[model samples]
Target: MKYNLIFGGIRNQDGYEENTEEVLRSFLSEEMEIPNVGDIQFQNVHRLGERSDGKERSIIARFTRFSDHERVIRAAASKLKNKPQFSIYQQYPREINERRKKLIPRMKEFKRQRRHAKLVYDKLLVYGEVYNPDAHREPPPTIPGQPLPNNDGDY
Candidate 1:
């Protein structure tokens, strides 16, 4: 449900559907050496998004259980490190994706400064420093007929 394996940079060719599942099974079982992954049940295995010219569409494999999903992710993390043609990602909700997007500028800033930075959920952590968007958010607008607070220290 919340977890899925996304396969990126795999080329789509004619008759791709006929061999995709088998190919993925072989890649995980043999190449990645993930034990018993072939026995894992996939709720769905399909390409995500529209096919674009000269671009390979990503493959999304939805597992029936979260544990199975995590296993695949863990296995792929180290196995695909040197393999540029393949990559894996945890499937996040749209809201989380949007929140992560907002932190891209900060992420880049950290990278430019040569500080290791990454986004975990809605917060951005750079060199163990936390940047919480909620903490810095502007206050909500005051209701109509509510008196505004004076700035001169008067009630």
Candidate 2:
């Protein structure tokens, strides 16, 4: 889903954010200050589900252009680090999600060792190069029901 990204942890208000594209646009450019955000446009924007347990619902925004999606993701990968209350994520399909589940532990270990690792789609990049799992020995899989790494230095 090159054009989609999911963001959560922003405070919610009834009838806010989803109704107007301009509000979203300014939030990107003025609030988030994403570079070249004026060039970004949304085709559709909506919250994922009804708020439950008083938790803020995540919102999925579909970009009007692929480059806009890429630009936002890249800017978010860097900018959101300083803003813990907000986070943005590139959405993945089930197949890519499965592959990322396998790569996450290794990605955590790499970050623990202070090497750069970012998950892009199904592939993990170690120090900006595609991580080849077969080229390295990885830890055994975590127990099926246990918690996975909440943040594996992913972008």
Candidate 3:
């Protein structure tokens, strides 16, 4: 899959407001020997505040191509004068595809459980015979203080 090692400089010049497009153009416009780096773009921009020179602004560039970690890094390195604090990464398309492949069975299992739980809940909500048991009238209660007959209600 195509991946980009995106990075660029923060120009510390007076009123230079780090134009990301310019830096990226400088990188992509070059004739690169590496086969990877098909196109380049600025992914993000930042203001790193004033440096010793004056206003400091950062430019983040993305080099798009299909290559491994080492190749992309090497390609980016060739374009820069100083060492870059970069993060190695893969393309989103590749990562998403891999995750989808892994999630198929788990998603099926989750759907199955949801259906089963819904069935049980529906049955409970229906108020079946077991939920409403047969109702009968209660017998009259005997008074405790009443006098008892010979073979009758003695306490």
Candidate 4:
């Protein structure tokens, strides 16, 4: 089934990075190829118009379909071990175009910088560490399955 995934958040200093993008692209490529799957194209990624007080950037990712979206979000949530605030919504091609219209200026700047850096340095600093698909093996299922208390004292 076709699925759309939308996620946005304030990025850390190093987020929206080339390496991060590569990792995500590779993961998505692999994940979307399983049996009973549809295309998993990356639709859009953008930096929010406004910046935070800490000078951090906000980024958004829009996937082509819902199942694809879910798979990516599940992978992310697993990696972070938290419920993701990322969202999903079905959109017509027109709606997607409208969204990208609003996001273009910010995205254009990044693209421009990338081009400039390539001309100047011959290469840009990008995420380089390779990822092993099975690197983070799931812990064994506990027989009693005792859940731990929240150590953050939020309770």
Candidate 5:
């Protein structure tokens, strides 16, 4: 599909069979305040799964156009920052999530060195550069239960 998928953080509610399209439209129009949100068309709008840990299911949406996706992401940052019951973000497959999880260690390793590391999506960047494990070589060793060293010799 040429479209990106979004997930709406839905809280618990009774009878989850409402018109998802209308709900999404109102959310974008009123909550997100995105211009011409009605112009955005969503496909496969539905809930993710049954409730778990007393948490409500999420609504999944697939819409075309990268501009619409970016607008939603930026609007979500400002609008949903204080709304716990509401959230909007792009959804990734399980494989991608797992890959990002595995990169956590590498991310920490780079940060410990004070090299300015950040993890975005499934990739890690150190000092504004993408990290390549093979080229970077194995990080310096440290004693068990000891923290890694920084630019200085101090731990």
Candidate 6:
């Protein structure tokens, strides 16, 4: 329940197998300035998937206390704000993950088109344009015997 996901932190590929947790702990303490990292108990620190093309895999760190997780994340938001190569994210449900995955390509497309793009929850904002998949709906049909309202504001 208390966990954070880290992306693009590790760089070296040679000694990663032996230093995965150490690297993460160091990052949390040094870079993120997370207090009491050593004192805080962690459930695990592991890669999300197999390494490919010498790229480091994303890390999943589970902590024993939710406060520790929140502390790390809050520190990371300020510490890593200007650093684009590293990111810290809170764990979410599978449905949210699926929705994020669906929006990834659209975000990329916005970038490709040289427009600013940001995903806020389930909505996609591109160059100040908002796209909400669930917001679109057809208007209700009018009754056959009822007269349509005047559009010229004559009343």
**lDDT score, candidate 3, position 103:** 46
Ranking by TM-score: 1, 2, 5, 6, 4, 3
- Model 5 gets an lDDT of 0.72
TM-score quality measure for candidate 6: 0.61
RMSD of each: 6.4, 10.2, 21.6, 20.8, 7.1, 8.1
Q: Model 1, 1-155: lDDT tens per residue?
A: 37677888766655445566666777788778888876888888877777666567888888888888878888887998888888778778889889888998988888999999988877799778898666776765778897776765343
Q: What C-alpha lDDT, on a 0 to 100 scale, does residue 80 get in candidate 6?
A: 91
Candidate 3 lDDT tens digits, 33-91? 44434343334433434457543334333443233335545655464434453232333
Off by over 4 Å in 3: 1-18, 31-38, 53-57, 62-72, 78-155
Query: In terms of lDDT, which candidate is stronger, 2 or 5?
Result: 2
Worst 10 residues of 1 by lDDT: 11-20
Query: Lowest-scoring 10 consecutive residues by lDDT in candidate 2?
Result: 146-155
- Tell me the lDDT of model 1 at 150: 75
Which clashing pairs does model 5 show? none
Clashes of each: 0, 0, 0, 5, 0, 0
lDDT string for model 6 (1-155, tens) is 33665546655445545666777778777777777778877788777776667666777888877877767767876899988778777667778878888988978887899989988766688777887655544545678887665655232
State TM-scores per candidate.
0.70, 0.69, 0.27, 0.32, 0.67, 0.61
Candidate 5 per-residue lDDT, tens place, 1-155, comes to 23555555654344576777677777788777788988886666777777666665777777766777777778888887888778665576788778888888988877788878887777888877887777766677778998878867577
- Quote the lDDT for 138 in model 3: 42
Model 2 / residue 33 / CA error / Å: 1.4
- C-alpha positional error of residue 53 in candidate 3 after TM-score superposition, expressed in Å: 6.2
- Model 4 scores a C-alpha lDDT of 0.45
Top lDDT: which candidate number? 1
lDDT of each: 0.78, 0.77, 0.41, 0.45, 0.72, 0.73
